[model samples]
Target: MLSIVPRHYFLGFIPLAAGAELITVFGVVNKASGIYGLLSIFTGHPITAAQLVLNIISLILLPVFLYALHSVRRQQALPVVAFSYVYFLDMLANLAFTIYFSVTWFRVFDATATAEAGKGTASSLDTASERGLSITIIVLALLFKVYFCFVLFGYARMLVRKAGLRSDNGEGKYMKQLQFIMLAIAPSFWRRGGRRAGKGRMVNTLEEGIEMY
Candidate 1:
């Protein structure tokens, strides 16, 4: 049976993620002036440099993402698990850098002062509605990424266990910790507790089990 959800659609963000980073890398490189631009040499940010490296790393992983999407779409455990693992780690690093960027941007008073001054005293910097909308969008994006990562982890676990790949009957330490992190981020992961009843029994974050056939 065909899966109801376009599980492959989750992978659609791959290019956007890569493109955004590529843009940022050049922004930091050329020292362009704007929100897209990173810090200037006079007031450099270590995190901006870190973001450049990670963005390059992400670009290099584009093939891994493609393989993951293909594997997941075909229900192939080997490549799905392999690339999913890599992508999840990449995503964790990405999230950390995102937080770092937000913090660093907040502290960049020179740019903030310049931007505020350009407003010509007509409006305050605090625009509550604009700030609220931005925060909502960011929070939603983060939540979706976390949930999808968890789904990948769970699907891989189900496959490995079903195939009887491990005699020890345990998930790996890294995957376990990653799943735990996801669970902590999303409390609605109640269905995973019932996996003993069946294999591929999804407790949906998106599917609430939507990815399963």
Candidate 2:
């Protein structure tokens, strides 16, 4: 398993595991609220398929998130590992939805921009700036999610190793694949290199394990 930081730094992975669950719960709530807001404002219109899917997912996972949060707080091994896998898969799903929505938004924006350009109401420079800002936000969000995945999986691995769980015995090959995907998806991660353990220097920080993965 890839180590995001020294083993001792995680304090048995309790804090990170609990924090991950809490963050996910909040995220699900936020998504639910956004969906509700859209529905409220567009009461006469049928909701899009994307919104329906997101609503169902958020509804289904909210209870699961709560259960996982409870279990992780008790330091349960299975739930921690399971939640890590769920979070990783959710990250991929979020990526797919993000791409779909981004493409859809750009298409609609392009049409509006064209119309506004003809009307002399909006400039191409303003459109480009908006696009750039949206893309930047999306990229940053994905990068942060990628790093959080590492932290979560690292914590899960620690828990499994501690509990002597053989359920993850064949995970090494899959983990290599995951690492490859991470590197390919976020090449800019390579530029964030920081301190490393070498020359008798003790490594105990998250930055120290950036290259270790």
Candidate 3:
């Protein structure tokens, strides 16, 4: 029999792939607009556009991160489990942020654009519709991410339990017993002791009777 890749893995990959494309495509396509828009987010001043390219490239790593994360099949120890959890969180947060930014970038318009276009117009309604669709995509991506997060948690815990239940690869060796200064403390030794005590008392009583005579 042949084994097949499960459906859930495919489902999980889709969102991550979508996010990777969204960020890198825009960041590169609008390179002239300056990737440095992100600098304003960080130090309150925009840096060179060259710096932004790195940020855009970083977003492309999300799918790779997701693939790497999904590849962690087992945790050999408790700390591995913890690491897996943190890894999953980082990946999820990265992907979610990308999805959020993509939605705003493609579906939303600025106040100036909206005001100039005027309300009740076809463009405004189209923007609103696109925003709604983007929101739906975001929600679906979130749900998929949340599901996989729980799956990783459960798998990590299972790995921990399996690790705990595992038998150690211990070596069994025998050595000469140490000769104790004390007598052997086995039950047979105690039984012999009781009999010897009775015999000693009998001998003492006989000696006493002979003296009394």
Candidate 4:
């Protein structure tokens, strides 16, 4: 399996992958809001109870995202590895939830389309196009998630490698397991582009001279 080490997170600048981590924090906020909505739904009826539980589990795992972000800011190696693992797992859980919700949404939409068509207010062609658009958006979002996971795991690998950590050490072995799992789950398309980040270039340019005393 090929290892993915991105050259830069966005564009040709932004040395570290922390930008993605920050974006991930916002994503977690969105997920938490979504979970709240799902919980509300569960209150009215027992529907989607399983999704509620899965989302709660995912939310419970999110504190590490914050912890890891802080550690990455401090340039700590081990905690970054843990952050990478939490991110990978969170991506998987979210993928499952996204798929389930998309399917359920389409089912409900189809039923609604049937009702509207019976009243001659909805055109079948218009409904089909709308459904197609929704599918395209979902696919694009999932692809982005896969690529984001690649960026995160690569960033962690870069830190571990730079810190002179031995692969036989506990953290190293755990990271290797994560890499293996990502390689198994990620599609081939996720491997293309963004590997140009040079070695030792991860430190932000703005913070370059602050450590000297």
Candidate 5:
């Protein structure tokens, strides 16, 4: 029987786990610095209340993202749905970060001209520091992103090559699409696997081919 969830979904968990770790670190930093208030400034008159909403949203998204990933690993069609959920959560977090930074910069500008600018100036400096930390976390997240794509590419390649082997054909649409996506990332993977060699020979499994290359 065919597995309902692809093996690649399990492979994806590694990167997802890493991304979660980065987000957790980000959340801790936000809590430590009380920059959450800046988020509230955008939403309403009382900044603390607004920050509370933002924190709630972040708290909600983190768990939802993890749950989605878990569902994908366990259920049929769940991977697709889970991927969508995780994607949306990731986008929301990014949007929140952007808003947070913009508010901080605006506060900095406001503070530059006022007698009471000292507090705003300090807050702005802290915001900048926070943004720097977020950037570092984002870089770490990107590392996971690369790994996720690599695993996906490996699985898709396996499917394509398997189809070609059965047909004794030069190439198939699935194989072509896989090659295209892989090429978009690492051209080396495409060049090595998609290159024309002896016809009708079964391509090794994705893992074996990857090892050989």
Candidate 6:
């Protein structure tokens, strides 16, 4: 089911594309002089904008990363399931951020002032609305970041374990390589699978599949 050379490099760009969507959403907030103003001071744009740019960079490097992952996967990498779970968490985090931003923006913009008018009653109302929305996004982002960090650390541990396994395995050259690759980024696949880690039984079941394979 796997190919030595990926059938399409575009698949590697999926994360980047998703990141771009986030940038677009953030742009809306930036134009309104919301959190983007504060973010621009440090990141040259809002955090969301920075993330979008980083995503583009990641997209450019995805092919190489995927190749490396393919190599690892073929070797039956370690912490396979756990690593995949982390990637899944990362994607979900991004999606959650997007949804939260979108909803908050809509809430802020509903029946606000027009884009024209430089300074007036309408402008003040718009600013107030934007500020409220910004606060909400900030809080949500922090919460998500904390949750995501936990997942990231867990995934990192799995990756470290997988790396150790690679040294021990000596068979199935191509398969082992593919296995390693899959484990390396297995979190992304797990996220795509839409499975939750909250359920202990389900998590265990998924981990078993990763271990057995």
Best by TM-score: 4
- Tens-digit lDDT track of model 5 for 18-121: 44334434444544444455555576656545456666665555555455445434432223323443454555665666567667765764555343445554
For each candidate in the order shown, give its overall lDDT on alpha carbons: 0.50, 0.64, 0.45, 0.66, 0.46, 0.45
TM-score of each: 0.50, 0.66, 0.39, 0.69, 0.32, 0.29
Candidate 5 runs further than 4 Å off: 1-47, 72-77, 89-93, 109-213
For candidate 6, the 10 contiguous residues with the lowest summed lDDT are 1-10
Looking at model 2, the pairs that clash are: none
Best by lDDT: 4
> For residues 66-144, could you state the per-residue lDDT of candidate 4 as single tens digits?
6766777777766776676677777897888888899899999999999999999999999999999999999999887
Count of steric clashes across candidates, in order: 3, 0, 0, 2, 0, 24
Model 5: how far residue 113 lies from native, Å: 8.0
Which portions of model 4 show Cα errors greater than 4 Å? 1-5, 34-47, 169-213
Q: Residue by residue across 1-213, what tens digits does model 3's lDDT show? A: 001212223344553323323333432343323334565667777554544654665555445444443344223333334444554655565576666576466644556457657754547667678668877887787666555454444444344345432222212332112111111222122222334755786899999999999
Q: What is the lDDT of residue 112 in candidate 1?
A: 65
lDDT of 5 at 185: 46
RMSD of each: 11.6, 10.6, 21.9, 10.3, 11.8, 13.7
**Candidate ordering by lDDT (highest first):** 4, 2, 1, 5, 3, 6
lDDT of 3 at 197: 57
Model 6, range 61-163, lDDT digits (tens) per residue? 3443344344334432343333334344545655675667666666656445444344355666666777687768867876654443333333333344445
Q: List the residue pairs that clash in candidate 5.
A: none
Ranking by TM-score: 4, 2, 1, 3, 5, 6
Q: How far does residue 181 in candidate 5 sit from its true spot (Å)? A: 23
Candidate 4: residue 205 lDDT (0-100):
46
